[model samples]
Target: MNKISESGVIGVDVHTIKSWIDQDDVVLVDVRETSEYDKEHIPGAMLLPMSKFDAEIFPKVLGKKVVLHCAVGKRSESAGKMLIDEGYLETVHMIGGIEAWKASGFATEVQITPPPSPSELKNQEPQFLCPTPGEVLRDEYMTPLSISNAELAGCIGVTEKDIEQLTQGESKVDVVLSLRLARYFSTAADFWVHLQIERDLEEARHEIGHTIREEISPRATASN
Candidate 1:
């Protein structure tokens, strides 16, 4: 409970939050629903939904700054007040919560549990699945190269969202990104492009099998 002038709850912008994350000086609390948090959230935020917020954790976070955030900012503001009223000296909440963070071009991570081990994977039945290009970027490049999304984006002359989206599977890899990835990894551009094609085809096949069938007409060709 670091003290910061008994002034209700201080509001911080996304920039300040980024700095805090880089400097390792802040404890980010996602006071949103677990489901919401699971979809996407700040890279290092801890989920403590407003529904079951634990005042007892305040003591543990004492000495370090604590910041709370919800989908927008209202819930976090309320949660901040609760902390303040409960004697947690200083508290801050993101001015616009997760939405603002994303709008500001910051990186977000989907909260998926790690995949099973090779042994476990072998035990499971085989399925027609394609890995996201982002998964490849993360495991094959980012982790091996020890590079952050910001660093890669800066070097490759693209917005962080471009890299983040590709890695998170939210966006497909276009010609431009494929070239960039290939150039950065010293691989052929086709390698990256093919990854996207494979995933799209697999997903399309899966959806077709699960959904109702629709009739299709053959395309007419030009006559010589």
Candidate 2:
């Protein structure tokens, strides 16, 4: 049995694999079936199922750092070892595969729909006014109420850059600031909710604002 070194075989979790995909430095090859690949996969992963590995597909990926993944980790590990033996110097495997990626709070392309249109946001209110006491509002209404760093700055009257660190998830949530947000959004919700749902809120608010701007901006003259 040929033992691969710990460092030699990079055991990446799915989140790191996603980062690698974004960078375009590595190639993700799923050694699963065509049916499996079509169902859902990492955005840029090439499908070279292990069943067809002996064919022309496997030879082309040689001399590159090949990150192998399957539904679970079992098949990928086996494929990684084979690639290493076949003279591919760098072979990494995603330890927990796609399921691990989702569990780590990383977004997946599967089952996601396009965001709502501008008209949708403009008609919607940021606050969820209660019809009955303690009733939970729809996810659509509650989701937009969360403030982003940009909106948070707007709420408290601060510069965009002043809250840039906060947007990046680096800054600590200030309790005083949280209280201020609750007041600004006209609710007593947690500050971290703002940080968590900031991006969604920003897009929704911007779209609504854009719709208003378009409606108000004067139409251009036909003749100069």
Candidate 3:
């Protein structure tokens, strides 16, 4: 199949594009003015203003499959056509724009925040960061069901000393502890397992914070 084609384009509704936001492989570009974007746009969309389509924006997106959108369908259609002509592998325009998106029961919000930087993209991670230090302590020490440290330690066949040491950052996480904890708590087995495998909870906590602030916050915005 010809990778680059204008006539064979597919137009997706806003709701469909919204559902694809969490897919790591998809890239959604909004071909609207900065002002329009600030007022309201899809969460996680990267803006490549229609007025500024040039070598700078064109080259980076050349070989990738792109989904282009605007406030209505007009600008996105224009942008997609231009991108196909510029040798983009595939360019699909959003059919109904933001209004059609909202009409389908997908959420919308005015994005007061600026777009993420390239450096930000390079450092992105995942959720499980927003919990308080006390919560982290609880996750480590307290029983998952009862929220009592003593109870949890007993169920896991570990002394309170073990739980205390883990919570106090004194003991390095171990696979044995992780397995026992997973069975006892029935929470995120991989997270506990990862603590042992990676041998670094501080680093993991720090990374989780970045994800919470960047990627997770956008979803919160959409819901509001």
- Candidate 1 has what TM-score? 0.46
Candidate 1, residue 112: Cα displacement in angstroms equals 7.0
Clashing pairs in 3: none
Q: Who wins the TM-score comparison? A: 1
Worst 10 residues of 3 by lDDT: 126-135
What overall lDDT goes with each candidate model? 0.72, 0.55, 0.58
Query: In model 3, what is the error at residue 139, expressed in angstroms?
Result: 54
Off by over 4 Å in 3: 1-8, 55-64, 111-224
How well does each candidate superpose onto the true structure, as a TM-score? 0.46, 0.42, 0.42
The positional error of residue 134 in candidate 2, measured at the CA in angstroms, is 52
Name the candidate that leads on lDDT: 1
lDDT of 3 at 89: 39
Q: lDDT per residue, candidate 3, 8-107, as tens digits? A: 4467766556656655546788776676677777777788765565523564644345688776555566556555556763567777666577778776
Q: Which 10-residue span in candidate 2 carries the lowest summed lDDT?
A: 129-138
Give lDDT tens digits, candidate 1, residues 76-190.
7656766776787567888767778888899899766789999998786634324567766775457755899999999888999888888887888888888887677554455
Model 2: lDDT equals 0.55
